[model samples]
Target: MDITGERASESLMEDTTTEGSTMVIKMECTDDQPQMRENQEEVEKLKALLAQKEQENDLLREKIQTCQAPYPLTPETINNSSVPNYFRYCTGFTYDEFNKLCRFLRLPDSETVTQTHIPLNCDKLDRHTRHMPLRQEFLLVLIRLRQNFDLEELAFKFQIDIQSVSTLFSLWIDFMYDRLGVSVWPHRDIITKNMPDDYKAEFPTSFAILDCTEIKIEKPSSLLVQCEIYSNYKSTNTLKSLIVCDPRGSIMFASALYTGSTSDQEIFRECKIKDLLKGLLQCGYLKRGDGLMVDKGFLIEKDAKELGLKLNIPPFAKSSLRMPVSDVEITKKIAKHRVHVGRAIAKVKQFKIVSGRIPNSMLVNINEIWFVVCMLSNFQQHIIQT
Candidate 1:
């Protein structure tokens, strides 16, 4: 093939000659222009086909890489990092906080690790070993709670199955609740020492700020269950939890989830926070005059009196919607100081799992999840300044 896109077939011949004798030579050239053109096209088609096969091979390699888990989390990978806040990126815990949690939730015993696999959120019990590292298991739980990743998403990321993800979360959440929940009830000294100046000046003896925070939950199929949990105030099905904060705005208490239909005052009475207050007073964590800061709707003045504690509640005007100037000022002061409680609740809600409307299946462990988030919130920086 030449520049003219034609092939030239040349025939050469030489006349026989003795040594040192000159020889006569003849040359003939034949060009099959059309056949050469067809051969050129065929060669080009072969080249294109080769390139296409190479590209297909490259794509096959990429798909293979995608199928394998190259970087399932390991402690060495997290700790040997060059970047700051890498731990926080993975599990929303600073390095110090992560280490602190490691200290608190020490590696569970074999009994703690052996969770019942039947009838959880998964189908079959995968007794076959998929040995995820303990820290990675902890990280998986945090990621699910903090980021609210579904079972499939977590299973893929951590190189496990959906059943393992469910079982691990249930096991770890309950373990965390048991370990951390017991000590979350604030000590009298912690609250008093951390109380802010505003509380000191306005309500100096304030024991705690009380409020009912509601978490939206899936509507149950059973109408009776629905009726039990439906909340007129939230205008949806929800579970109510009593979250109390000290004056400094750290969560002092987070009660278990109750029916949304439960009144705030009813929750207040039944949750036995007042009983704890009595114990605190008996233990000298509180004095008789140290009262709970609450909204007017929290009608437990009689209970407070029975426990020998005062109620720093706002006055209600019967005849008119106006109150005396002193009464209004007192109410304003209570409202102003109670803002930290709302901020404390907001901190707990930052964990989107408990903050958002939870699935119906989660109702079983919702209390533990809520308690864990509340307990974890206390480990973060203060919700209010001293």
Candidate 2:
């Protein structure tokens, strides 16, 4: 009975040991299953992240390719093409004429002209981006003047942003005005040399023909400014300038722009023409017998007489309904002489910026633009036949 009881106890101990080992193995398998699921989830997340990075890289490569693509309208392409074609298209000048103008201005070759030639406050310009060459800047100004293209259009044509176009246009306009404005007003001797024989025979003592020209502008927002620039003649808001031209239709002097409401007489006085006349007298460019042929608008007869300068204005019939034949003949002669000044004004207005209503944004540089246009007109073929 004792042996049988001992055998049963040993069998029960073996069975309990086997059940404990099985539970321990099952727990280890369950823990490993959860760890395997977590590792799979982690691997899926890594793959998703890698795919997203590759997509971004593809998009970046596409952008780089687009940026690197050559544009046909780029400055380099234009320069590489026939200079005559671009010169006439870009600047209204023939190749020979353009090169002659450059030589006259003491500028280097067009390729060598760069932004460094002009002084500018370039703090706002991006240093990382490549800058447009100087000749391109010059061409930009001419294009703006010749074509009157706005900033956006110019930006597209030049393959640059609008801000760069604006900056370049403004800086180059001021630079050109500073460099070329002085040449607009030449000495009286040069004017005399170029005077046409018709002018000499008709008005032997006349030095210059004086006139006023009006340029239409966008109406200002302010009521006072609107009133100040409103013109009765143009029936629109305008800016006015006093212009004097030699008989050869070369602009000798151009006054700073005045409000269109101002009269020719007011412009004459305010522009200090009397002082200019005084200087001319002192320099012997004008003597006692020298005259400034003017239209009736000038009304400076009394003031001019005080300075010993004759005011050759056409006779106005204050009371008569009709003038005598002699007076009519005199009016015809005066009108004929005055045509040269009108032609000079027309040449300056060929730059469409001044020909059309100027935008208010451009008002700040209007005077400078006016000076540039007038000065550039002198470089063109003379208005009157020599």
Candidate 3:
């Protein structure tokens, strides 16, 4: 009995040792649980951050691809492909003619031209890298005027963003107007020398063809502005200018833009054509008998007489059903000659930007744009022959 009791005590001791060891292991696991959880949480956070960074990297790569040139061009490509395409699509000049005009206008090559040379007052150039060469930029502006392409369309063609296209257009328009607009008007002696034979024979003293041309514009949101710009003749909102051309249909003078509500007679008066004529006459550039060929809308005969100028106007119906046959014949003859003024206006309108209704966004520069378009028209072949 004593032996059995001793064996039972030893087994109990072994059981106690095993239970104590298991308790120690459980305590250790409890102590490590919070640290393990923190480690797991940190791993999850790092994984999430890695995924986010990877996504950002992918976006940056895509942007880089988009910014790459869509149509790469070397000098050969520019001369061979781009020049001809631009000539046909926008400038209406042959490659050689375009180059000549660029030279005459003092336009610098895109590669060499500094950003400071662009005439816009805004900081648009700071927004993006200059992806286009200056030559391409010049062509882009000319094409925009010639075709009146939407900004998006021009962006796609030029492989640039729309904002860049718009900025380039604005800057180039300003440049062209500043550089070339003043050159459009030649001296009165030049006009006399370039007079067509038909004009010289029929009206030897005719100095210029006088007319008011209208360019339709976006309807204004303000009722007052709409009323002021609305034209009864065109039945649309418009801006009007007094365009004077030599007998050969070359524009010699373009007045400041006026509200369409202004009458042709009023535009002539407000534009100070009389003052300009007076100056020319006093300078001995024009003779006292030198005259302006005009349509009936110009009722400045009295003003012309006071200025020592003649108004070659067609006969008016005043209150009669018809005029004398001689007056009718004279009207026909005046109309025949005056038709060239309309043709000259058409040449200016060939630039669809002027021919079509101008967007309100563009109204701020409409005067300059109008002047530039008229000047550019002179770069084309003569609208009339001698």
Q: Note the Cα lDDT for every prediction shown.
A: 0.76, 0.78, 0.78
Q: Give per-model TM-scores.
A: 0.73, 0.76, 0.75
Tens digit of lDDT per residue, candidate 1, span 1-386?
67444322221122224321342222111245667898999999999999999999988865554343243665557767888867676666776787677667775423123223222222333533233345567778888888899999988877777887888898778778878866455666677677777677777677688989999988888999999999999999999989888888888788888999999889988887877777877977777777788887788888888988888888887685668899988888988988888899998888889888899888787888999998888777787767
Predicted model with the maximum TM-score? 2
- Tens-digit lDDT string for candidate 3 (125-243): 53333544456677778777888889999778777778877777877777777887553445667876888777778888887888888999989899999999999999999999999
Against the hidden true structure, what lDDT does model 3 obtain? 0.78
**TM match of model 3 to true structure:** 0.75
As for TM-score, the candidate ahead, 2 or 3, is: 2
Local distance difference test, candidate 1: 0.76
lDDT preference between candidates 1 and 2, better one? 2
